[model samples]
Target: MRKVVGIFFLLFSLSGVTEVKDAHSASHTSVLLQSAYESVEPGRSFNIAFTITPKEGWYTYWENPGDSGAKNIFEWTVPEGVTVSAAAYEAPKRIPYTGLMTYGYKRPSTVLFTVDIMSNYTAKSLPISLEAEWLVCEEECIPQYGSFKLNIPVEKAIPNEAAADTIASFSTHQPEISWWDSRLIINDTSSALTIEMSEEEIKDYTEAYFFPKEDGVFTYSAPQTVVGMAEGLVLNAERSNSLNKPEQVTGILFLKTAKGDHQYFYLAPTLETPTIPKLSQMEDPIEMQSFPLWQALLFAFLGGALLNLMPCVFPVLSLKAFAFVSAGSLSKADRHKEGWAYTSGILASFLAIAVVLIALRSGGDALGWGFQLQEPRFVGLMVIILTLVAMSLAGIFNIQTGFEGAGQTLTQKSGAKGAFFTGVLATLVATPCTVPLMAPAIGYALTQDSITLTITLMMLGLGLASPFLLLSYSDTLASKMPRPGPWMEKVKQGLSFPMILTALWLATVYGDQTGQLVHLFAFVTFVAFLIWLREQMSSPLKRILILGVTLAFSAWFLGVSEKAPDRALSDQPSTSNVWTEQAVSNLRAEGKPVFVYFTADWCITCKVNEKVALQRTETEDMFKRNAIVVLKSDETAGFTPDTLKVLKKYGRAGIPLYLYYPKDGSEARLLPSVITIDILKEYIEGKGV
Candidate 1:
């Protein structure tokens, strides 16, 4: 009966969607699967798109989702004589929150995969099976399982007009190698590289991203850029602070261009060159190896330390420690028991998080942190929780759980439980705090063996819970607390300020994730509901009713609502253009100066550059004065054909790249991924209009 009631309440609480399980849909729900194919021959690669439309608010994972979530499972049941390789993915955007990360498509995103069918395979009917597993979500995420079996015929003659049109469209969008200046000059002494190009290719390109083929060489986000004389660009790549000089610097060069993205690959053999320029060259492609294990563990430890400082953990940890310290008459042994209990709580929470993450990863989520909070409804729920905590601390209500004979109320008798629960709550709240200190550690942990992974997570938990543990286990610490007095009330009320502050921060985050209007509406509703709940009798039935109301509101606000707003470029220019190497080359060939910026939508360095350099008034003015074209190539989706071309041409693949081209048809000059006002001025002055 209770289960039935819960189910009924869940069904009744839903908004913005309806579920139908008809006889036909019992075996398979109404799923829209769109498939398109292209041919890959010399100078061209085929682009294919397999779109699976879920019943809205459903998703699939990327290659990695840190901590919790399932990986998107796909099986190919192909027809005879047809060989297919894994589809290359466009670089993905990173979303970080708190301590957890997940990577996947947020909206009704189409998964684009490519196929290289030999010319001989044309005109043949291809039998294929597309078996996929994904997570369909609207609050409570559900795993979806299905397989698509279809026989698509291949044409022997030239592709039909409609097919040709579709193929052409996909091909145009496919990633390809673009124009790169063939000359590369590397200064090992100063750790700099310069490439000369036409001045007209880029105007005042900034915010460049570079993907170094070799790891531990150049740091991911620290290249200094300078525009040199004539049509050339110079890059001063600082050697990794932790290591000596690398044998060679290789990767993709992503720059900004007017036509959208200006992406190129640069693979130049390490050469000792003086002041004169060196001719650039490309080499056979090499695949990168995964990061080693010990390093991953170390990263996890560091990440764990940083997690303690996160908004969620900070409040909870501080409160828990204060609670322990306030528990005056407790013995040392009693305090130790509380410490163990708190540890147990934290460990249990970690286990649950791990299970959820692993399940979602198995189902195919991507590498984003705190993605569960992406919905406004969830954020609303968190706000409600924080508000309740603040109200409770302010003595707005009394919560008693039996134990009347023991003369201890629920909040006093279970200080240990409170501390432990605090740990769990901290984990729940800190999902949006992904930072550089935590990413590599969590990222590496995700790819590790479960034992190692669990240990790493536990270490993180320990780090976050350390303060509470120490406080709980130390009677001496408890003795240090001020004797129970009027000052205690002042401190309690003061602590509520943090809660209020946290609530405000969450509301703002929620607003940023959704629209300001949605946040405002949600806040008004939440405040009104809280006031009403406070007015109602605090009876058992009323408490249950309030819980139901809270859950219902959360579901509606987070689960049934639209996706979060993209706050990446709230202050940036138009996003219509995607830079490509071919486009950059074409602009340069057209005798136009070009400014190329290579960056990932998720890269902090890239974001900073976008704000300070490219978007600056002076930069824009200089670009206009020089009649320079602006281009932005994104590497967040990995390497596209256009991205690959740019990477190969420039002999690079890492991000935060910048390049410049004069109006001449000569090679492009490599600029530093990092830039300053003086650097920009020098480049503009060197290449006179």
Candidate 2:
């Protein structure tokens, strides 16, 4: 039957019949074109409507057919001086079939068009033609077309009462542009359109749904949750996986008032910034808080223990190891004291950081773990401290207290004070590396109370300080350490290189943040000059004066470098586009796969992943072959609110986030924090679990 109907329409379309006809019926539908006036005067406007009646149990589509249908098409041929406006549609009913929701007319529907006749005196008759095409569906879909022609005598206007009455009957069905105050609020995962209405206006409505004119605005199959507010109604809809941030939301809102009475209104609301809720308040799909509090603490402790292996923290741990080797000659009691002092240092430092984070958040700063590194001044201070430590270990300068019995350099001292400061330095450098389990633990901790945050962080610090503390306390562990000897000096000098490398990395972060390489160059040169002066001068008083001057100059330089330049002028990667919520949506709408990686210069793990997986030739080739759009969001400088919202949406508080959106409109897959080539390829190929 479907094939026969298709063949019949195909034959009729090719027949090229030029005879006048006002109505045609075939394929379970009837179409007719009628004018409001039988005759019209020049310079006056008239209404023409195309009335479509689908047979029982069948339907035809509206301008924006939801989910899976095409809209009706119309082509008009009129006189040269005449103007015809596009068709306007009435509000459509929600038609559900075969588990898919669609918008169309199940009964008779009219699409109205306006035509203006020229003012100049013309011929006695005006001929008009229309080629109409539409799709009608019952259990199957069939294409239908009609050729419509009509002639009207050009004379003073004469009303066609029947036609005028037909058009008037459906006029109230058309949606009116709403005058109610409304706004669209969008976050990473969902969107809500809020409309202000009086209590009287909403009292009768029991249900409501928004039908967006634009495709991909919302998931048509997803249920819309509506909440009644004191001022109005908020229709919360699940955002389509492939959608981008819309400039304005244009749609028809259908309200079911009193079951039989339905109201439709048009809405075009502008986007407004939404107030992001606390992490605990969000209904995150990833179930970030699924694990118990004990599990989170365990994760934090293990993550911190693993952080000792990171490049940024290893140099400081190496220094502590050297101190442990030297402690072999010291009394067991002194070693125990040193271990306790170091533990205290680690716990105190973590507590201090927790306090500061809590205070800043209470003041409404949207910060996360490792947020300190985002500040240029803080990065500058780390660079200076690391550089000085490197120079001291390299024997360029000695950090002496200048008291009678305090002649030993700081790094060479095996006392409790030196060990304590080493633990503090270790904690400082460890912030930039986010290892496995660390992101979820910290994300959970930050959402907790102050006391919980402090305790979780203390557990992490305990893990970091465990190895050296155990060595100091246990005789067996102490015996395993190499004895201090002349060779220790060469080993110390070798360790200086790692400190130098760490310092250089931090300097790069500084440059990336401040966009001022000249300042870094000058600071390095100044430090070199100070090192030279210390070696050349023998007078203690002059040396003290030089040290004071260096301190003052360093302070001034760090203060001056805190002012960052405009980010637009900063250097960024040329190969990838900057990540934005809108750009990602637009690309997805174009049916292109997208790979977006969130990174930062301060994040060592992100840099490692980029060098090992993202920057490889095979990865580039795969991307090019697949026509994938790659975007990079650098948070080294600072995170935009949208970026932060995205992070929170994925249950993270920091970067090294990798997301792969498939071209087939599947939910975006979150890649591993530490990605290898095989892992990335697997995710891109839809083979990941």
Candidate 3:
């Protein structure tokens, strides 16, 4: 599919039927832009191209010219209506010319310049002169100048397909999204955009360019991109070493995707978050600290509705629907009653969760809506329930006699009970989804009185229950259900698939929270119990006995395991390199300048900065030459007390932290949350003595 899409666009480029005329050439070039000038209309822009056919050994500078280099600049001379603007530069690679460097194309190239027209005007042709200066070097730097006149008929409007496809093609080569790692994630709290690129793809590539779409979000020249991770060419880009989290980070990423003659743009990241802005007396920036009440309510409602579709909630919903349909021929009133009961169940559960969250918030428990699942016991309980569903479907256990099998029929009355239980199950599943979104809402609610918070929670509950309510009320929907028949038996059996799937999924969650080995043991034991339950039922009591034993074993496993510590190293990879207390202590003992990165895989911002700017050559060399002992500690899988103490020392509640220690080891200098190569170098070279 991707190949087909790429080819379709490639063909469009070949079909742009435009003619070219005047062609100029330099001493070292074979071909140049023939008729590259286009007239700009009032309030419109013209994307003019300057193509170069180099004779080899000649190149251009990217936006940044590195430590010592020059970038290509276009001196445009046009009518007042035509304002020349650089089409955001497709970043260039660093060409080390002698001891100096430059950023631009070395082979045949096209530089796109967007010219803006202030007002509408008419002309036979728009004439413009180009004074282009570039440092073309082989051994000695050669400064070159070009003077050319371009006269092209100005059409009333830019051609649609011709111009649209042209620009779109340029965009295809840009990075679509900026991410820290495999999963695409970008965040505002962090200062720099982190991007992880493949080593093979960037093997000959040596620079990172950030083209910001918004100002006030980031400061230019504060930092440069650096290489953080080296796993298969994975690297982290942080804000300059000095700045931590910027108010906002927004930009496009242009990395080297090919070698030699042909190279181009790969990604464009567009979205800027605000930093602390000066807004007189009444304006507060949008931070986790200052989420607005209306925004919170809106997010809560939307998030609540989305909760109905989460995988964890599906089983309960299925169980509910099965019960709802089984209620036999019901009067419209009874059906209405059942719908209200289900809604009540959902609302009650949400309110209960909200109460718990409020209490925990007061007690300072760091508790969120899904906080219960953080307890291994709760997760273990879910595992047992899933296992039971699986067993029942296979007809291995006589348990849950109300339902024939994992997906079997339920007695009409029992089915109604199932519907109620499902409501509860759904409430549990909805917690994780709601917490993150709710955090902002609740945090904002905290500024209001308790009544407002309660109302917010209520609104959230209403949204969550809306879908199930819709399913209940309409007779048409109920009638559309497959009539009670033998096929339900097969359908019931199919339900077991989801049950087993849930068990597996819950196991993964447990594993992530605890350890994989522990979950594996539980999975093995559950499977064994199922096997034993089959083929060994003598009487009802004996069957009950088997169930008891299974439950006891599961309970014992839960009892033996401790809730994984809050700071347990996370299963998710670190966004930055790991920094441990032991390593820091050792470094302090050795009197070496140490840079510590405390991060977790769960942190989206952490990952973004890692990929975009961290993984560059200059940053790597900076670390190496400075003898900067790099240490990292991840809290995703879990963290230890010592690590917690370290985190507290840095005054951070989460990951993606940077600390710089001087050789003298007075007090570690807390670097900004965002980082880059230049910042790291300055810290080490300027402060490390």
Best by lDDT: 2
The list of candidate 1 runs beyond 4 A from truth reads 1-295, 310-312, 399-413, 434-437, 449-451, 516-550, 564-689
Q: List TM-score per model, in order.
A: 0.44, 0.58, 0.43
TM-score-sorted candidate list, best first: 2, 1, 3
The true-versus-predicted C-alpha distance at residue 670 of model 2, in Å, is: 1.6
lDDT scores in order: 0.52, 0.76, 0.54
Supply candidate 3's per-residue lDDT for 576: 39
Per-residue CA lDDT of model 3 for 1-689, tens digit only, reads 54554344334323432333234444565334333333334566656666555557666545555433466666778875677776455444445331122345665555667666666656656666665655565534555455555555666554434344445544544444434343122233224343455544444454444444333323232233234233322222222222233343344454442242333334443333444221222232111112335666886776567667654467666766665555435556656665666677777887786677677657854432345655666766777776776666555555453444222444445444555556666776555442235444544454445566677777777777777677778888777765566666665666667778766766666766676546555565665575466447778877677767766776677786554554534754562345656667676788788877765433333444566546677777877887877776654444456655554433343345667776754346655445555556555664321
**Segments of candidate 2 deviating more than 4 angstroms:** 1-291, 400-414, 531-540, 567-576, 686-689
TM-score of model 2 (CA atoms)? 0.58
Instruction: Give the per-residue lDDT digits (tens) of candidate 1, residues 1-689.
Output: 54554344334323212111001121112333333432123222343444434455444444443223565666776544455566433333233222123344544344455545554554445555565566654334566554454444454223323334434443443334534553333333234554554455434453344444444443332333434335445555443223445565544455655444545444453445555332222232121112445555666556656666644556665566455545655567666766776677777877776776677767854333454554556666777777767765665643331111111333334756665666667777555454334555565466545665567667666765666666676666678865545555556656667877677766765555555545555654675465557457658777677767766666665555454434476454765455765687567667788888876533434555677777899888888988988888754433345654554334342345677765653234565445665566555545321
Candidate number that wins on lDDT, 1 or 2: 2
Q: Least lDDT summed over 10 consecutive residues: which range in candidate 3?
A: 281-290
lDDT tens digits, residue span 1-689, model 2: 65665456545544533222266677588876788888888888988888999999889988888766788888889887888898889898888653246899998999999989889949777788777779898767887877677777679888777687668867878898888878877776567777887666665676788888776566665556665556467676666645676666688988877554778898887778766333244342221122357877998888888888776687888887777777776668878887877788788889888989999989988777788899898898888888877877777876542110111232324377777777888898888877778887887787677887888888888888887788888898777767666777787777789899998998999988888867786897797678669667889988888888888888888878864765453553363488888888888888999999999999988998988999999999989988999998888888779988777656576878998877877556666678888887777753332
